[model samples]
Target: MLGAMSIDLVDLVYRFRKEEKEQHQRIEGVYWVTDLTRCPLKRTYEFKYPELTAKDVFSPVFIMGDLAHRGVESLIKEFFLDAASVEVEGSREVSLPNGRKVIVRGRADAIIDLGDNSKVGVEVKTARADLGIPQQHHIDQVRIYNWLFSLSYSILFYVTPDRVTQFEVRDSVDEEEIIERITSTTYPRYPWECSYCPFSVLCPHKKAHDDRHR
Candidate 1:
């Protein structure tokens, strides 16, 4: 049944052309593996506040310390125009292949702009003593952070209980011997080997070697 209707075929064509003219396509940026890996770490750190769960005995002391720390941070922030803000880029929990879950969160205390065209990541370690880490272990920690966060360099801020010396997190460097040790699938050197390691007494391999030597 063909009825004599004014079929506006040209109007339909004009509408189609208008619809196809200059449309903006939303493009999603591709994220790398390192970007995805940071999510777990971010979640872990943000959720678990160990201090909050702990008893209130240490609360006042912590608050006081934090106050003092923030003051120093304010001064440091003024120095870097590029990295003027201390932002929590990511804080999450990450899982290892061995099924152990670790909170891998890092807050950039203050990023220092090198003035030319560079930046440095600062991590304030406010403590009574220096964070004594096995050389190889320290290198691994720094190296991994450097790679993941795309940091050119980092600073380790160490503060004493007395506040005698305000420890600034500087590029104090890790040695090549530590690098060599990291590459090798072996134990640490003499002095480091003799250090009070938690794994020592329980190490069956170490016990066996000692027995054989005896």
Candidate 2:
């Protein structure tokens, strides 16, 4: 029974991640709104070496996050009714710094209609630590969602082991900034990104801590 359970669990997680990957599959020439949040070079690597980066491994952290997101969405639906929508799909087309146009797509966790011709985008994130409750990448992601959905404001909600908190992002990035960000190749956008990145092994620009200073 243990063996069977293990197989079932593995299969279930794999299928779930596979479906998610397909849903957010990368287009050859287009950019995802998430591209602006992470290391731009990671996306470039994904495009350049699809085979190497395509597989999704089992992760307990990701599974926890998925469950939390589903729970929160369910609660929002129950409480907010028609005023809130979950997994809201949105996209925008912007010209890159190189003069080429591309589509930037993203799905916001939830959007709440204020009934005043204004909407608020919500981005739910699950984290292990409360140290950086509102990480930069998460802030950027919510801002991009605001830009994509033309939302008046965005809320970055974090569910950590210690607490549940949220922050507001009122200002969104413009097309020019988005273009510049998407076109940049800076790897490991944050100093801590490489440690959590799947492509760190093969990434030449992976950031490493200076042990000498330690």
Best by lDDT: 2
After the best TM-score superposition of candidate 1, give how far the Cα of residue 200 lies from its true spot, in angstroms: 20
lDDT of each: 0.42, 0.81
Error of 1 at 19 (Å): 50
Consecutive 10-residue window with the lowest summed lDDT within model 2: 205-214
- Give the Å error, residue 214, model 2: 16
Candidate 2 residue-wise lDDT, 1-214, digit = tens? 4565445777787788888877776787777778788888888778777777565445677878888999999998899999999999877888766677788888888999988789998888997778756777788888788788999999988899898998999988888888878777666677777776778878888887632221
Best candidate per TM-score, number?
A: 2
Instruction: For each candidate, give its TM-score against the true structure.
Output: 0.40, 0.88
Model 1 over residues 68-126: C-alpha lDDT tens digits?
A: 56776877767665455563354334444455444333345666666575566655545
Local lDDT at 195 for model 2:
72
Please report how far candidate 2 places residue 5 from its true position, in Å. 13
Cα lDDT for residue 106, candidate 2: 87
TM-score of 1: 0.40
